[model samples]
Target: MNMAAVKLQTSVVSQAGKHTASVIFLHGSGDTGPGLRRWVYDVLGQNLAFENIRVIYPTAPARPYTPMRGAQSHVWFDRHKISQDCPEHLESIDSMCENLSAIVQEEIRAGIPKHRMLIGGFSMGGAMALHLVCRYHQDVAGIFALSSFLNKDSVVYQAVEDASQCPPLPELLQCHGTADELVFHRWGEETNSLLKKAGLNTSFHSIPDLNHQLCRQELELLRSWILKKLSL
Candidate 1:
């Protein structure tokens, strides 16, 4: 059990209604826990029926993104060169999966059922969400990946296959910006293809004219999907 107790900043919003589920948001690279307050308050908070669901935003530790970047930012794992078949990148995925598993476990201990939980993130955080949902053994309600890519090499494929044999796959919804320059649009296409090939139920959406960033339209779409999944 090589685990580290990482401190995470969290907030909860409860309304005068039956709570049906909880969503844990993992922020993208360079964003802090408090910085995501707007997303929680404006986007998800306003759109979702707060009476039935709650949201948690966790901040990652600040770590050097690269040996040369010098500047450190909040990230689940070290940011490395983007490659479809990079071994080092795959290793980073493993490390992040471990961290995400611990976070999810903590949430479960706090009374959130495994099937009532939704894990998601944006950009690099999106990558982590995809990795954890595929590797984690429990059944999650759904996974929301925004402006992200999957590490779809042979090693990752094997991991997904093995996990599927033992545990049920969770529903997956992926949203990508067609005009994203930071992570090429092709990455999203490839991720969808890989998941579909593996026989997982997945939905993919391409936001038109969007760059490597989130927009109102995309946020609304995510909100609708999450609510529908939770039946709230």
Candidate 2:
């Protein structure tokens, strides 16, 4: 694995009135940073009444996605199905955590407070969000994982166990489509159960009659959650 810095393209949407919070959006695999621009306008823009809120969309580095051949896309780390007991998987988890920590630190240096920052993404991006929030060193306002799965089962289990000896975890919102074929709905169930069992504050919603993509209602629900989280 390369420890080289991954270049991230960013787009910021500023609120004209009173600012409340800052949301950092990470896009899914194969999608550019600007791909989530419409989500800012449609979901956050229209829903958030506060003028001070800002939305930051960051693009992941384009890289080869292993296991799934003939594919290259934006990914936080190389995807591999290591043995269930392998410690190698934890190494990948740590790499992602460090990458996200750097990004969060950058956001804080740019004026976003740790308490007012929200991290979220869709698909692979969503998986990154979930992993970061669980293992992050600092506190964030909220976390949203949409159409995504937990990175790996064992790592999450260990994180949960460790969290028991520390302070509370941040609030988490997970949304998944029951009909999703790519990332099966079972992933959502497993993640939800794991997080809940860990005693973290979490909310899970399954969209009916939907597939791998997010539906209009799901987007609306996300918008609402953002507003409530930010108190906008």
Candidate 3:
């Protein structure tokens, strides 16, 4: 793990009216920003082209993924396994998070306040989003994690514990499928529970019989949630 900054390729969905807010959504392992751009619109049933919301989709740099036996993948960070017990690759995680912070800094320079921006993603992307927002960008408007979970020993938990005084934490919205075999429903539940206990305003939604993917209902809820947060 080299700590050198990597510039990620990004696809932006510009705002219609004014650039009052921004949403940076990360893609899961092996997925690119352009790939997620299409899927997001297709799943949400509409482009995120909200009146004042600019959506940025960033592609991860290709790196050797451990679970795939060192095969390269466009993942925000690498890990030994998806289990909560697996140790996180902090070197790569920190390097990638710094790259992501560059994107956030650019938005801030353009006049978007941290409180008017939302960060989120699906699956592995959601995990990275949790790390980024929790460890670095706590002043963000809110965070959304879909079918996602953090490791039991994640730095996010430690960060919360190390805080001398509770800051105004971001509101969190997490949605998981009851039948998700990949990420497991219980993981999402436990993650949400832990965050809530850490004093975050968390809302969890469960969809019956769904699997490791998103559905119309989930996207509908996500769209509404983004709207409400950005409108504030």
Candidate 4:
């Protein structure tokens, strides 16, 4: 069933979670979440390997993304024309994060606590995951961001910094390829630092010779992490 609460259509993959955990994985620019789901299932040959968890893949809606010459495409948010310079578009992110938060709420309403779920993504989608989980005032199980980075100077980061008595941030497992020509490796490191600064428990892994993609090692690490999280 497609989740209509979000601006994009969502595809779900049901897994057995110990009392039912959940994961929401967003897709990158110009890609659908279902496509990512296929790669995850067919290419990776995995099922999330948990007892009873639902994996959610959400597709990005068509929008006037500014990065690719402002052409219409699927993207979490509009990448500034200057490309990672400054003046983060908080309004757009705010709307999207609201939708993302709603998705989590749907999961919670379905009988999962904030501690029994994790939100993750790759590339731009990863950026969205990190941004929403950290910036928006929401509680979730954890976060796993791959080849992703945070917009340090954005309102989202400001929100993280401004909240003096904020609720505890979720644990994070973030990884990036050293040779990532697309998102740049340093952003990943920067995001990790920011999360730590906010007192969030985050683990950062740098994949050597890795590019703007995932490796088998990365998948294995993710699998191990998920299993550990599920306590299986």
Candidate 5:
């Protein structure tokens, strides 16, 4: 968990001209950057076509996750089970946040303001995304978490509080299914409540009759949300 931050590989599709904005979407534990790019590309094409926006899907570092039975997977963090919590969770999250910070810095150095970039992810990736926004030194255009959990710490809470003092902490959108068998619903509630307590702008959507996977409704909402954020 203390490994130096490695530059994450990304599958990028961008406009040939100057990019008005950029988005980096992190995939779930077992998913690859290229795979997520296809999903995100199709979703955006269905509703959003801002030709100046650059969309990227970044690969996670390979780790032999215990839940995967020592099988290496591109995961943002290590956890034995979706809902299981442990002391090492903090370390895992910090490492991932550092890695994400590196990605955000790259965008900033490319003449894109951090506030003009969006970062988000699904499942474990979602958890990492949320954590990165909260823990990092700066904010972005926005962030969304799908089926993710919040970190447990006064330190993280303090960071969110401090970030909010700067005004306009990256907008937070948390969506989770009520019947999500893996991460469960309560964690989503906890995340929402935590952000609210820190005075950060955060919203939570509890999808009814949904499971571990994204449904059409969630997809539509995600598309709309991203479009709205980008337009800002």
Candidate 6:
């Protein structure tokens, strides 16, 4: 795959002063970087803003979605099905991970080290975050996945298990809702369990009566985590 093909367009939320750190957050399927940026401002407001940390929201390339029956959508990867039972489509996944790594590398060249950056997203984007951090950029500062999961027998577990010396996985904050019908809450819990078992610093939160969407409580936790992880 051409690296330039996956170099995505982004919407940035600039910080107040010189940026000391960066947050590269991906949007869910069908959502653009600008759309997610708008939602973050309108819904999250000040909860996710910082004085010296720039937030970059990258838009995925529009492609044919298998689950959506060939409908074109902005997705990090094509999936035949969106359930934990179905295996992940690694062909597109590996490509997207490389794409995300390019973004991280750009940040590195801009003076922000991998250890000073966080990677994360919601739903499908969250799944991409998992692959990007775990399989490609394990040295990142942290990861946050909202209402997301990994496929059965994920390479993440294998990467951890197969390492001769245990890799230094980043701190992870994962939140899921009990009422989520699309991606089941159990899948998120299982993801947390697997990550912890692989010795990652993982934290899982369950929102009662919540669905496949964000809530104030989740954003508050994310803000706290970000402050603790990447604050100057």
> By descending lDDT, how would the candidates be arranged?
3, 6, 4, 5, 1, 2
Residue 38 accuracy (lDDT) in model 6: 79
Off by over 4 Å in 3: 1-3
The TM-score that candidate 1 achieves is 0.85
TM-score of predicted model 2?
0.84
Instruction: Report the CA-based lDDT of candidate 6 relative to the real structure.
Output: 0.84
Candidate 4: segments with Cα more than 4 A from true spot: 1-7, 16-19, 162-167
Query: What would the per-residue lDDT of candidate 6 be over residues 1-232, giving only the tens digit for each residue?
Result: 3323467888888888888999988899999989887776667765267888988899998888898999989999988787777777788888888877888988999999989999999888888898898777888898999988888778877775554167667888999999999458988999889878877788999999999888787888888888899977
Better of 2 and 6 by TM-score: 6
Question: For residues 50-81, could you state the per-residue lDDT of candidate 1 as single tens digits?
Answer: 56777777777776666337476677666455
* Total backbone collisions, model 2: 3
lDDT of each: 0.72, 0.70, 0.88, 0.76, 0.75, 0.84
For residue 34, model 5's alpha carbon misses the true position, in angstroms, by: 1.2
User: Which pairs of residues have clashing backbones in candidate 3?
Assistant: none
Assess every candidate by TM-score.
0.85, 0.84, 0.95, 0.88, 0.85, 0.94
Best by TM-score: 3
Per-residue lDDT tens digits of candidate 5, residues 175-223? 9999887456787788779888887788899999787666667767876
Q: In candidate 6, which residue ranges exceed 4 Å CA deviation? A: 1-4
Better of 2 and 5 by TM-score: 5
Which residue pairs show collisions in model 2?
A: 17-51, 18-52, 19-52
Q: In model 2, how large is the Cα lDDT of residue 95?
A: 68
Give the winner by lDDT: 1 or 6.
6
lDDT for each residue of candidate 4 in 125-200, tens digit (9 for 90 to 100) = 8878877877763477678898887666755465555543665667789989999985679878887887678667
- Which candidate do you rate higher for TM-score, 4 or 5? 4
Runs in model 1 with CA error above 4 Å? Answer: 1-3, 39-49, 67-70, 90-92
